[model samples]
Target: MAFSDLDFLEENFIHYAKENTQSNYANKDQVPTTPGQVKMMQELAKQVQDYGVKSRYNEKTAFAIGCLPANTAGVSPIGFFAHVDTVEYDDRFPIRPQVHRNYQGEKIILDEANGVFLDPAEFPDLRNLQGQTLISSDGKTVLGTDDKAGVVSLLAALKYLHEHPEIAHGDLYVAFGPDEEIGLGGQRFDPADFPGVEFAYTLDNGRPGDFEYETFNATAADLTIKGTVVHPGEAYGLMVNATTIMTEFLAALPADQVPEKSRGHDGFIMVTDAQSSVDRAHVGLIIRDFDWDKFLAKEDLVKNLVDRLGQKYGPDRFDLRLRRQYENIYNGVKDRPYVVNLALDSYKKAGLTPRVQTFRGGTDGNFITKKGIPTPNLFNGGGNYHGRYEYVTVEQMDKLTEVLVTIAAEHARQSQTGRDERPLKKYW
Candidate 1:
């Protein structure tokens, strides 16, 4: 009684997972930052057409856009986003996906030589995946399940809808984006591609029932400290050590408000990287919070710290640049509760108990929501994302497909009758 083809999900996930589409931050200036992503996006543009979707590859935006026209009227266009790019991994070994059929919750060895094994005891979630077809990496490289599972699930849904013409639905827009791992993909998304689309969902990493509307309101900051360097023998009063200023700035930061200390609804300011020398110093940090006021406060704390240092030294010596990365999806969806209610209702119809939680990290939905579309995140059904331990189950992908199909059909029905307008609960 599966909604879509499980074989299709399994076959396609493995095929796409084998390709190295790891995004790079260093070459982020490029549209996709890597050639492999373009190859996959372009292929996807052509592949989706086989499912009766009108597709195109937008080189400017690096998004493979596909549209399945509505069979019924009155329902507004909705979009689904799945990034083709994955987090960077070692390239020495190609990604080789290992399929374990009818998994019995045993300790599955990925590579005995490397002592790499996925134990159900260590990952208790694997125990829930018993009797399911589990897919994982060969311990040499990533399986790219962070989103390949999402991509295939969307495809399976699209294929199922195409085959069953009797199913009523509205225009279904799908965008396979590039460079999401580096946080550049969604920023480059052109809303024009999904014309008239009011809302969207990003199928990113999570368990099957996971639904996230509130995500981190993120901001990145770069600080540069300038110092006057003098010869050590004559440095008595002339030498101003930049490293010392950087140390003071770092110490001034709220030590309690860090990633390890902060969890659940709490936010954190994390110093990602830092380098210092007597002559000059540079520090890179990022701020994140689910609450808008708290998010801004974190940014202000950094700015105030720099201002105090400037007062002690000289105003010209301390230069800090703060940039907003993305805002919480709650900001965009709060007024329009239907967007969330529709997904939750559809989840119930798909036999899933909606587990709404505040996302600790940001996704493509964050940027898309800021672009006038109230975008939230739906689970792609996987664990250990962005690493060798990453894995996904075929049944989980099938469940995601079922949820998507139900959402489309339910959306059409709701539009004709009445829309769900239930208010979203504050998870914090």
Candidate 2:
């Protein structure tokens, strides 16, 4: 499935993902900044300049540095972004990557001593990559390709256009941010600093063909309950076990609809944290769903459960707390169908059929949309993201780069027509 003369893209992409050394690498006992984050920004910025792309970079900032290409007469410049920080995982030192050389569709042996295998039963899509290359972990830690695949794809696209100057397109603004795992990516971003980026996408989705415009309407609910503590032998109704009450709250939650049990747009509630003692107890959970109405309903439902528990036990004797987190980003982009069409058209140009599914959780794209960047998300074919089981196809990474570049080119082509004038080959 490799494209003609596309070996360089695959070779360099795999090397970049492997060779990257940032806050996640094995440089010291304590996690140290590996310069991989900084290195990735510099490398891509360099490629932007070398490709005759007008771009910029930001250093000495927690948001790290970035570049947005200028939109010239024939070029439509857009930004593509991904994070450099990886989720905290077991592998904190020198890493090990298992590259399946021409995957044959069998169980992948990841750390044989530990019996770590990529079970197809667990990941049914392994059948889709019968002859493609895959990079996986040794089962001792995460694969880090969740976003590194994104970074590689952006760079590979630039390298492609750099070698072939006649591609004819608009500008590109590429970004590599830190702390996306910790959720600080858009906190320090100032879109005004990089101009002409009307719309953007984060190369942070799953499954190569996936195109995302919506993410979970996310929020959190925190609670607390109180009870009396007394000697067991002397205790009667005076001894109200706080832990027992906490268990009641947990038991009251709906079954068959949790993060692990749900799929697609199905929302669920899960207790992410809990603590208890005889005198008092505390609990917390995330309320996740794609629809905003359901999101609020879910939030109110958790609070209602807490209120009912307190009334049953006497309001003054027990306590409760609840809070909401971020909202669904669909409304921000829903009105702008062109943003979606932009993404879908790019996928089609890259030979991907373009599958659109709402994200089960929030992403930097949602935050950016709220911040006025109007961004959607693009997938890199990685599954089991944010965990040790993460894996992605090398072939998908190749297509992603092409998609990024082709989108910019296609937009530029459509720009001159101005809708009233005419249209590009398909748009017209």
Candidate 3:
């Protein structure tokens, strides 16, 4: 059952995959952080207009917003999000997407000289993709399938609805934003742009059946330690090494509570980077937890560690700063179960089993959920995201297109009859 054009999916995915849209964190002060992102966002705004979507590229927020007016009048407006940028990748070599038609579950060579290959034995999911079109990078750079697959699926669904107006649907809004890889895109999103949208979904990562409503509550911490810079031969009590104090602080963090050790609703405190000298030291840490109480406890643990270190060294010697990055999507969506129920229903209609699980990482939905519209995450239909080994198939993308169309049609039908208000179970 072909839901959308497979040729259109492959061609559009390859066309956008070649664009250099890698986001730069160093340029966070800018709206998009790279010229390539701006080019893609603006181009998407123009392209969607051809599919009966009224669109615009907002320079203030770096979001390309579009709205497809409803044919059915009773249903409320719903929205969708997909990023226009990829994570930071090597730009020296351009992204070249290779397509394999009717793959027979055999090993496909990406770069023979560089010893890069996509084997079914290594990625067992490839075995299920037999007889389908597979797409991958040439192994020099990322394939940008993280959210580009999401973008293409959404576009195909929109085009389908435009051509067949009999399939009654409500107003649909789509926003393609920049710097999502750098985590700045959603932070700067203006909610007014989505005017009157009740709920939204971000078609980000995960395989076809995967769905997530809970994400980590996140915080970023920075610590600075000051010490006297006396020579190694200086008097014993006068010389203080900042590196030693930094090491002590790092060692005091809970060993079991880290990204590697924590999984499935568990959270950890991670030291992203640390640099030290005899005169000064700085450490960057991130704290994540799914539970609100646990998240606060983790924050308190760091503050207490700093307090104890300040007592040993002078109180003035330690300075720490903690900033809230984003909150758990569960916090906002927990009370509004219809948003979750609606997607799960749509998935079943699209012939997918609902696999509701916790998202270990955060997404644009985390921030947007806080903005009063409870947004959950839907699958982008791929695996090995944000890397050279990333791959997505035409069938997987068509499945996503099917899911989006189902969500729209189902939402319209449910509006006329009654809303699904089933409570979301806490899987964590």
Global CA lDDT computed for model 2 = 0.71
lDDT by residue (226-272, candidate 1, tens digit) is 99999989999899999999999999999999999988999999999
- Supply the TM-score for candidate 3: 0.98
Model 2 stretches with alpha carbons more than 4 Å out: 1-7, 19-49, 53-61, 64-71, 74-77, 118-124, 232-240, 311-323, 384-389, 418-428
Backbone clash numbers for all candidates listed: 0, 12, 0
Instruction: Please give, for residues 286-305, the per-residue lDDT of candidate 3 as tens digits.
Output: 99999999999999999999
The residue-level lDDT of candidate 3 at 85 comes to: 95
Runs of candidate 1 exceeding 4 Å displacement: none
> How do the residues 13-39 of candidate 2 rate in per-residue lDDT, one tens digit apiece?
556656444354243332224555566
lDDT (CA) for every model shown?
A: 0.93, 0.71, 0.93
Q: List the residue pairs that clash in candidate 3.
A: none
Candidate 3 lDDT at 58 equals: 96
